[model samples]
Target chain A: MPEPIDFYFDFSSPYSYVAANLIDALADRHIRSVTWRPILLGPVFEVSGNRPLNAQPMKGDYMRHDVPRLCRRHGIPFAWPEPFPIATVAAARAVYALWDQDAEQAIRFAKAVFRAYFANGRNIGETDGVLAVAADEGIDAAALGQAIQDPAIKARTKAAVDHAIKLKVCGAPFFLVDEEPFWGVDRLPLMDEWMARGGW
Target chain B: MPEPIDFYFDFSSPYSYVAANLIDALADRHIRSVTWRPILLGPVFEVSGNRPLNAQPMKGDYMRHDVPRLCRRHGIPFAWPEPFPIATVAAARAVYALWDQDAEQAIRFAKAVFRAYFANGRNIGETDGVLAVAADEGIDAAALGQAIQDPAIKARTKAAVDHAIKLKVCGAPFFLVDEEPFWGVDRLPLMDEWMARGGW
Candidate 1:
């Protein structure tokens, strides 16, 4: 069996939201499993001298228009969050906490958080909002909130970002198929071809 | 008939090189023509606070690897120039000059210049290099040199860049189909689909 593809993403990234919608079906088509890893792009961007996509000047303007058009093309639900690019630290911590207990539940929790921010326009930056998302996924809101504040879970979230940075993942929706790094949801087709053909 | 798709590019961009190889055929398939506009990205990048892909740290590292890999996927020939990202002022001026004389010859000249820099690793920055590329395309080197130096042709090049800026073109290999903007070579597929479907 082939190694499961690693998907690294940030909760606040629109491109990551697009990838989250498609990656599972894409992986299933190849008869492969996917490992979703929620990462904090704040520290990574700091070290790389990059800003959030919507924070950059013209790029921000372009993305504001492009993201929804892309969602339409892909047939995915999309709604711009009211306060764009809200901090995802609490969301990342919650994902890590759930991941320790159940990887599948963690994925469910991550999708819920993405939908809350990108589909429902809810701010995932707040602990309460994230707790609500966790609750929707059948996780205990109070326990998840406590776990998010736990030092071990906090360290795990930090470690995930650190690991992504070390791997030179400067962008969200990054995928790694046995160490071959492919960045962006735009690269998904190429990643699919790479897996299908066993590296052309 | 649909408006000709506007292909705005910079000579120094690797993605532009990739797009240059494919745009014409893509247009032909859709029964549409392309208006190839060579625009300088220097001023656009400055105003938009953008840098060359290879100038950013981690993105630079990734692009150095990604460009060649992308070339292979598209079955296009690519060779990184010795002095990558050479100033394209002379090349752009020369292309504009030839464009005034003969549009077909101008495209031939532009493609030759792209091949010289990207496939042969030749420097198109120097006046002599661009002159040689023009000569290879059946243009007179000395006459082309004089035309490149002509104030009118220089203004044309500047005007092209200015016009692109007015259109909010912040990146190279930007495409405009019926006034809708699509940025990046990765977007070529989307652009193609948009043309085919008459908006999706």
Candidate 2:
């Protein structure tokens, strides 16, 4: 069996939301599993002197137009979140907490969070919103609240961000297949080809 | 008949070199012609508070790895320029000069300049280097030298940059199809689809 692809993403990223919708199916086709690693872009942005996509002048405008168009092209459902680039700390911590108990459940929970934020247009930045999404995935809301605040889970989430920075992951929807880094959801085609050919 | 696609590029951008290799063929397939507009990115960068791709921290490193990988994938010849992000004023001016006289030869000259700088790893930043590439494309070296220095040609090149900025063209390989702006070479697929579907 080949190495599992490392899929790094942040909860607030629409591009990550799009990648989440596609990566699993793509990986299954290649007989590979994906390891979803939820990360926070806040610290990464601070360190890299980068701003959120919507904050950048020209790029922000382009992304706003492109995201929906891309969603339509891929046949993925999407609704733009209002007050975009919300805090993703609560979502990340919850994913880290659930991951320790059940990786599959964590993946499902993360996808739910993405849908809530990107598809349903709910604000995942709010703790209640994140918990509601998790509950929809069959995770107990009260238990998840405690786990999200657990010191260990908080550390794990921070560690994920630190790991991302160490790996030079400057963008969401970044992938590492056999340690070959590929950034952006746009690079997915190349990633698919790379996996099929086992590297070029 | 469709409006000719405006291909906005900066000679110093590797992504532009990659797009330059593919845009014409992609346009031809749609029975559309392309208007290559070589603009200087220096002023655009200054206004946008952006740096060259290689100057950004992780993104720079990723671009270095990606450009070659993409070139190989597209079957386009490429070699890393020693001192990339070189000044493209002379080349742009020469292009504008030749464009005023013979548009087809100007396109050939621009392609030659791109091939010299990106594929052959020659320094087209220098006036002599630009002249050599132009001469190789059947342009008169002496006449081209005078034209490249003509104030009108220099102003035309500057005006092109101003026009690009006005269009919110923040990156190289930007395309304007029927006044719909698309930035980055990666966006070509969408542009192709947009043209095919007559916008979505």
Candidate whose DockQ is highest: 1
TM-score of chain A of 1: 0.97
Q: In order of the candidates, what TM-score does chain B achieve? A: 0.97, 0.98
User: Evaluated with TM-score, which candidate comes out highest?
Assistant: 1
Angstrom error of the Cα, residue A113, model 2: value is: 0.9
Q: Give the least accurate 10-residue stretch of model 2 chain B, judged by summed lDDT.
A: B45-54
TM-score of chain B of 2: 0.98
Candidate 1 per-residue lDDT over residues B1-200, each given as its tens digit = 77888989889999999999989988998987777799888899887888887888888888988899999998988988989788899999887887767877888888888989999988998999999887777789999899889999998889989988988897999999999999999888889899889987
TM-score of candidate 2 relative to the true fold: 0.96
lDDT of 2 at B190: 78
